[model samples]
Target: MNLIDTKNQLTEKKKHVEKVANVENATFMNIQLHAGEEVAEHDANKEVFIIVRKGKVRFIVEGEPVDVTPDNVLHMVPTERHSLHAIEESDILVIQVKP
Candidate 1:
């Protein structure tokens, strides 16, 4: 069992990635982005779930653009390509389930 205070991990960097949890079956991460910062398109090698924790973000998934706000949750398969752009300062949790 683990208890983490994700907000305390925030950083002033344009892009910050923090490992929140990891076990044999899954990995969890906290991603913080300042306005104008982005995570370039990439493929997730494992099934992935993205949870928007604060502010707003523009998500480009396989060439399609979708706006996301707090409480929005997105699911993607291993082969999916995606990217995220912060419309405002944002925080997101990324969970990847291994096969």
Candidate 2:
């Protein structure tokens, strides 16, 4: 089984910015954000969906900031310039569709 404690997965990949995934057409990632970890602004070719699994986050999209916490899901358009920061230690499920 591929059961994993996501919190531990974050600890394991904390130093790396990307992870190898097994999804197609779309990519699925169990992402971890250390407290204060900030992802720089970038644009996507297709819509990107984020689901906060643990902790808190702030989504900076198009120079606007959206605060988030567990159970919150945010979807961003392909052309929107977006970035993310972990306001507290966080675990996020990210799904991106490739156009």
Best model per lDDT: 1
| Per-model CA lDDT versus the true structure | 0.87, 0.78
Q: On residues 17-98, what C-alpha lDDT tens digit does candidate 2 reach at each position?
A: 4443655688777777888888888887878888887889899889999987876789887899988889988878778888
Clashing pairs in 2: none
Q: lDDT tens digits, residues 1-99, model 1?
A: 579878734454458898989999999999998889999889978999888889799989999998878767888899899988999988888999999
lDDT of 2 at 76: 88
The per-prediction tally of clashing pairs is: 0, 0
**Each model's TM-score, in the order given?**
0.90, 0.79
Q: Lowest-scoring 10 consecutive residues by lDDT in candidate 1?
A: 5-14
Cα shift from native, residue 53, model 1 (Å)? 0.7
Which residue ranges in model 2 land beyond 4 Å of their true spot?
1-7, 10-20
